[model samples]
Target: MIAAAPASGPLWQQVLVALAVFAAALHVLHDRAPGLLRRLRLGLARRLLAGRAPLARLLGRWVAPPPPAGSGQTACGACQKAGCAPRPADHMRNTP
Candidate 1:
């Protein structure tokens, strides 16, 4: 988790710090770049699952499924360029 960099400090500095942290998190979320929102949900659930607090783990249990296995391309090419994440099948009828 991001430690608030002196949220009590000057407002402009706080805003800049917040934005930078947000951008960094966004980059981490999107670096794979193919399935953006799917990745985000997966990532958040994983984080919540691994969190120290019991409340977080409880929330995770409500949201996430068992982790995906062999999710990457096998060259058997399960779903074309899309990684075989469980999410894609639920929305197969809709466009991203």
Candidate 2:
């Protein structure tokens, strides 16, 4: 029986593994604490893109808040119209 040698990957593989771990950690953070992540992104964008209105507008588009629950309309200024109308509740009553 041949013995298997210990596995040692190349430097690039090690770097890739580290990057994957970092990305996974970021994904978890974003999922678990989306509000915190959004605030951080907005703050960074504001700081980096200050005094640049066009760039700020682009960043604002990315960091805009999500639509209200069940509203089916985005809070972003792109939509000028209101959201969908609320459905009326069924009014049928039990009949003899």
Candidate 3:
């Protein structure tokens, strides 16, 4: 008996799925390692900018470089501006 071919859907659906997966991977990378992600983006943008071709330059316009690490603000933007109180205890609540 001959085996049947796999039921593959439209090319666009596959492309969309691939793009979504790629985006999610990038998101995870950014969330887990923000500094590494920032470096990667800055490096890519610089490489594009360094290219002589106009298309590269145009693409480089996107992927803006992250602000200098020192100047970067916390999520709330108030912690660095004002002062944050230190926690009385460093141990986790779940752990003794």
> Which candidate number has the best TM-score?
3
**Residue-by-residue lDDT tens digits, candidate 3, 51-89:** 999989888878857578778465566365534643446
The best candidate in terms of lDDT: 3
Output the lDDT of residue 60, model 3. Answer: 82
Estimated TM-score for each candidate: 0.30, 0.44, 0.60
lDDT of 2: 0.69
lDDT per residue as tens, model 1, 1-96: 988655588889889999999998778866756376566677888999998999999897776644457666554556655444545467777755
Task: Specify the poorest-scoring 10-residue window by lDDT in model 1.
Answer: 79-88
TM-score of 1: 0.30
lDDT of 2 by residue, 1-96 (tens): 999877588879989999999999889989999878777776766665664688777776666555446764544543545443323343355457
Candidate 2 residue pairs that clash? none
In what order do the candidates fall by TM-score, top score first? 3, 2, 1
Candidate 2 versus truth, CA RMSD in Å, comes to: 10.8
lDDT agreement of model 1 with the native: 0.72
Q: After superposition, how far is residue 35 of candidate 2 from its true place, in Å?
A: 0.9
Backbone atom clashes (below 3 Å) for every candidate: 0, 0, 0
